[model samples]
Target: MQRFLIALCCLLCSLPAAAWNGAGHRLVAVIAWQQLSAPTRAFVSAALADHPDHSRWVERAGGHGAAAIFAEAATWADSIRNDPRYYDAGRGEPTPPIGGRFDSRRQRHWHYVDLDATGRPVKGELDRQVERLSRLLGTADAPDEITYALPWLAHLVADLHQPLHVGRSDDDGGTRFTVENPFSKRLPFLSLHAYWDELPGPSSLRGRRLQREAARLLSEHRPPAQGDVDLWREESRHLHASAYPHQAGSLLPIVDEAFQRQARATAERRLSEAGYRLGRLLEARLRHRVSRETP
Candidate 1:
């Protein structure tokens, strides 16, 4: 019995390292739902009650870590390339498939696809994916399956909002450049790709600390208009153009008050936008479905 207990402990300890780092995003989702207009919250609550297991996906996806859930869902969503917007315009190519090995190269390409194209195609794909997910939610036989898939959908929507995640084919959307940590003084740890994903703000501040800061920022900025999508696209374009490895040297010099303030502001605004958009999508789906289901 003692040996068995030790084995279980070892297994549990190993699980966290491989998990996807999605807590920040998940927090955004939860908070976003909570902050919704009462009717919107009611719609989500009804949908979840109708499919109790779907609600649990939020916790499960966060548990297995971010990468695992993302890979699994991306794979599923990639299987059906129904969204026309993801297709390459001139070449007529489908977006590169999702859910295989994490090719930093291909992932970078996906980022560009999101940035350059209209959100319509991506939104269309999400709509279909959510339909499939909602169907799966209606049936309770596969709780674990639903757990992996529902959160996967949630995470991917958030990914679409990350400007870097919408990067183009060049520079693998910033993955090609290796740079040192200006603040840590450690060996260069991340590519521009990673810096966008993880290093936008303070590492020490996490969970509620991060969520509260993000919420505050969102409140201050007000909700974005559709035109803001273009603004986001242009911002990514400029960041991509400004790439110079030595510029990383300047990262730490400004890491004090100025950097922290700027980073927090940017992260907060972007993340809040992501949450708000996600809420709108969820609310729309729930309203449509509930109307259909009613007699």
Candidate 2:
């Protein structure tokens, strides 16, 4: 394995960040957390408690409750993109087990899939990885794998809902298409993908504001049906047509108020749907295990 975050670093230098920023992922997490049954939430909390980066999540949460911890856990997959302890799982030997524990290689490609014009995945492994990880989590005797997979499942379920995560390979999910946004001075110019990533809200979102945002989204968008992973990705792919803004009389596309409003609305609805789907998925996958193991 490459010691540094090689591929992720290269992608970060050239492209925008993950499918959703920290806030978007956390919002989805909180929304899901709100919907989960008590047993499932307990099981989720216990599984995450065994994670290697659990301490890091606690520290980052900064004296928050279990909800905050779960929310932070949702972003762990993205947070490790730059962490030194995790390395890229290159074509090297499989990461060896340490003390009989599963390895923690950073599989950054798990966040998105690049599709060809025919909708075949040209690159990335979002759907397949989620399915593979879900199976691993469902197994009876894989504590280490469950610990590892929980965070990834939390992150990827939300990612597959992002339109550009299922985007075309021609522009690398719109990362090649630059856009200008005069509304925010901090981000005047960025890729269309990055602009969509930030539409759910600021990366620093947390506490009451995060709760309010999640509540608002859940209220506006009713709990979506429990769609399969492939179905979720297809839904996102269908939304790609409207994800990009029409370029006005300028060389670069500028995000106008109307487009931003529409994008934000779409993003919030997607986030709500992802949250409910994740909650239902976790309940189905983990409830049986919890019932068998617990009283």
Candidate 3:
């Protein structure tokens, strides 16, 4: 178990600092938060008021308002990973058993599913969480339940768009594939996954201007035509096979200018697509609820 965890961290490190990382997740949430109708925004904000982190959110958000709270909440699923308070007291696992029937256990895997090089399937938590979230919302469950599930839904939708999340890496999701960075001063030790993870650029991208970036991207692009979850995964798979890194006899991935531009473009496009889809998904869910309640 210890070895498994060590490898997981190493693999995670191989990913870029921003790919489905804090900045990326925040960007997705901000985008969705911006586009949600006033009614949907009100509903989500009210549901989120019951979150265990509401006090902390208030502290962190300061005067940023509910949108900031909602954006930060998008990262809660990832944040719980470090907080032992969320862990089961007796079992000492990160997943604490809520009174609910849902397998609120194993919060980490909710972000992604990985496949092997041989094309054998590995169970990912994202699909399971999506279905669970649907049922939770469909039944018109309490806000507390929706609050618990909503973060996962928002986050997983963004994670679903990260090519590395869906694509199989030869080196444990490319945690092993080292990179020769384009920056002349840098060494060739960074992993390919790490390189792609920063596709949106730096961690600084997660600031007050993230909304502007998301808005600009939205203005520039349209939602992908084939936008189903399954198709999204397949698109990632195609990128994994063809778009990730170009091999040129180097033991590590040596990213050239051309490759960097193409890869960055792909990542940017995916972020736009993710934001659009997440907004649409939330809007559709709200519409569904309204339709159901209208009778």
Report the lDDT tens digits of candidate 2 across residue range 235-294.
Answer: 999998889888552445778888888888899999999999888888888877889765
Over 4 Å off, model 3: 1-19, 88-106, 117-120, 184-188, 204-207, 249-251, 288-295
Worst 10 residues of 3 by lDDT: 97-106
Candidate 3 lDDT, tens digit per residue, 131-163?
Answer: 567567656555566777777788788877888
What is candidate 1's lDDT per residue for 150-258, written digit by digit as tens?
Answer: 4444555555455555554444444554444445444234454555556434433344554565556566767765333345445544544433333324332113445
- Model 1 segments more than 4 A misplaced: 1-23, 35-150, 185-188, 200-211, 227-264, 292-295
Task: Score each candidate by Cα lDDT.
Answer: 0.43, 0.82, 0.66
TM-score against truth, every candidate: 0.52, 0.90, 0.80
Q: Give the clash count for model 3.
A: 5
Of candidate 1, the 10-residue stretch with the lowest lDDT total is: 101-110
- What lDDT score is found at residue 142 in candidate 1? 39
Candidate with maximal lDDT: 2
Clash pairs detected, candidate 2 = none
Q: What does each candidate score in C-alpha RMSD?
A: 12.6, 5.7, 5.5
TM-score pick, better of 1 and 2: 2
Question: Who is ahead in lDDT, 2 or 3?
Answer: 2
TM-score order, best first, reads 2, 3, 1
